[model samples]
Target: MRRSLRLLAACTIVALVCCGCGTIAVRKTSNVLDYLYPEGSPAIPARDVTLTLPLRVGVAFAPGGTATRRGASDWVNATAMGGEVTEAQKLALLERIAEAFRDRDYIASVDPIPSLYLAPGGSFDNLDQLAQAMGLNVVVLLSYDQAQFNETTNWSITYWTLVGAYVVKGENNQTQTFVDAAVYDIPSRALLFRTAGSDVRGGRSTPVESPEAFRAESAKSFEEAIDDLIRNLADGLKVFGEEATTGRVRGQGTPEIEVKAAPGYSGVAKFENGRYSGALGPVELGLVGLLVVAGLARRRSA
Candidate 1:
């Protein structure tokens, strides 16, 4: 009977705290969520409508990674955790891109089971198998480059769940905050699409070692990274998406993309001398700055 009273008190405390705190948390998350990643469907070329039919757009995800063990680069490896990513964040990004193409009205509905690229000797190794199953003519494979760093986390102790442990505190710590991103074509095993997109990394302190701290840290980390990725993805999809589709169709020779940058960012191109000159636009850089600031502020508050 005594043990039950303690349990009830702990629950009551947590519930009260959450009632006061949860609303702000939810609001910040909802706003931040939009910036996580920004992607959209590619636009079909205006000149080539007569010769071809609308193609199916498929997303093929590959194994992801972070820069360091401190969780400073969490963005790099968040997606592959299978169940770790939020439905809203993941589906929102995919939908934006899918809708981009759907707006073209030439594209059919986006496929549900998007393809995935596996490590060597994994279950789904064959490209042909994926292409066949997806019934896809075009596929987008996104990649990540470590963007942010920092792993020092904050802790607010709360009651513990054990029989005697009381008032366990929650800690916010950082581990990996990497920023890596790219898009590729699945069929022909060719690199049809790519993006320098948004590369912003949040520096988390250290991951909180306790279970509660770890859970909160993980969820918040995932949320922040997902938000940044979505914003940048959206920008890239809008700009290069259509052009990438165009290039895949008829662009056989080396090409260069002329891009106007926002302001101070070093707008670097990949290929030179009439090779593959990929142009990154203003929208991506702007979004990167916005998310980076938000992540830093959140880390400080936590």
Candidate 2:
């Protein structure tokens, strides 16, 4: 019994070292620009615009020789696991993105751009063509890069301090995913918004693992990161465009409507017909003074 207890204790220590062995660090890099609408462009009231999420999701690697090669290798390995992204996963990803916009009421409706309309690489250069094909007023272009690394350390297990094998190895795997999104006005070919988000996850695995494990872990990391990315993206949208409130629609660059009140004008302002038809004259000025006095009186009485 004593000998067994000692062996169990050693195994526990080994497990701890194998599980919590390595150090991992991650950094985020991004550039976000405020939303820009050109002069004289129509105010895209949320309820009046239709947005599309193309069926094809883009995958891009970081530029530079080594990083690009590494990214390509990682993508190849990721795809080899479970043999490519299944139809269900693809649909889920698309629906998730659409739902993000729908929850915010950012557009009148969300539609999926057919895969046939997308190019082989899923680049955004053909966005104008896609918008024309789908009749979409707004197009959201999505692209992402994923980088993964594995570091191995030397460790061995012994049997009763006697003859033992040193073939087993422990590994530390770290993954980082960076996402970029841009919103475009199809008709004008204007880029209305641009933003990015990144996430990193690290863990330890034994036996050097399989591609399947890597795929599953990477997918989980991506899902978590995507939620935050969508949230940030939505927040950024609120800054650029107007959001509808309970009783009013909020927006910038909206055309002002002229208010004309006849003789019995009781609300807010009073109008007098004269040379200055749309101008606020003495009667309108008097109405404003009356309102201010009445408001002050009511407050005092209360």
Candidate 3:
């Protein structure tokens, strides 16, 4: 009987040890390619692009296969396990992006669009509809991918004691996030430029606290990645402007660009071939000419 008891105890211990060595992983992603080309890749035709000055722009997040809203507990569970981005979060992020372009002279307005308006794999046709409805000439789409993994360390064996589950740091957790922004001209269906950012974070946590810890870390990672993306986007805009001015961007029959003043804009501005000139209006020009002629007459009399 003693030997049998000892054998049973050993088996129980081994089973518990095996059970402690488990892992959990979750992934959530919104891919632009998947949203734009659901059926398959289609050949895109090149077309001319006319860029009106003071462009009306819209920004939005790409839709993925997930619910847009959830309860508090559901949100905690979802975020802890790398679930989809919520609608509220998307709006907040889009607002931040809009601020980046709001002050630019070339942009008339930057509007935040909700993901609900777009369907996955909607392609250019969907964009065309949205552009028309919103009076937007350009659109910026944001997509993201996030993953979280949790695994038991060798020290996890202590979790069997119950108290150790709360006090022992035996869970290894890692979170990785990536975000991308693609700018497109709505009329021509042309991809003007794109920028991206990514981040990875890792830490150890007690088994009981892993869920909350993972959630916090995941949010932090996304914030950091977005900051990086904004910096890169600024650089990309500068480079694109330079290229457009040099005529290099117009190569390969990409798109023919024409710049014209927006309606209701009274200030005289001339933009040709991606270059801006003639800042003065006709009225100002006339005054300057009059001053020059008057000065010339005075010099002759002297």
Instruction: Output the number of the TM-score-best candidate.
Output: 3
- Candidate 1 lDDT over 179-220, as tens digits, reads 334443343333443543332222222122233433344455
Q: What is the C-alpha lDDT profile of model 3 across 200-255, one tens digit per residue?
A: 99999886687788778877887888888877887777776655665434455567
Alpha-carbon TM-score of each model against the true structure = 0.41, 0.49, 0.74
Model 3: lowest-lDDT 10 consecutive positions: 67-76
Distance (Å) between predicted and true CA of 96, model 1?
Answer: 7.7
Residue 203's lDDT within candidate 3 is 99
Residue 24's C-alpha lDDT in candidate 3?
A: 69
Which candidate, 2 or 3, would have the higher lDDT against the true structure?
Answer: 3
TM-score of 3: 0.74
Q: In what order do the candidates fall by TM-score, top score first?
A: 3, 2, 1
Off by over 4 Å in 3: 1-21, 65-82, 248-253, 263-302
- Superposed Cα deviation of residue 241, candidate 2 (Å): 1.8
lDDT by candidate, in order shown: 0.39, 0.47, 0.74
For residue 4, model 2's alpha carbon misses the true position, in angstroms, by 31
Give the CA lDDT, 0 to 100, for residue 67 in model 3: 23
Error of 1 at 51 (Å): 10
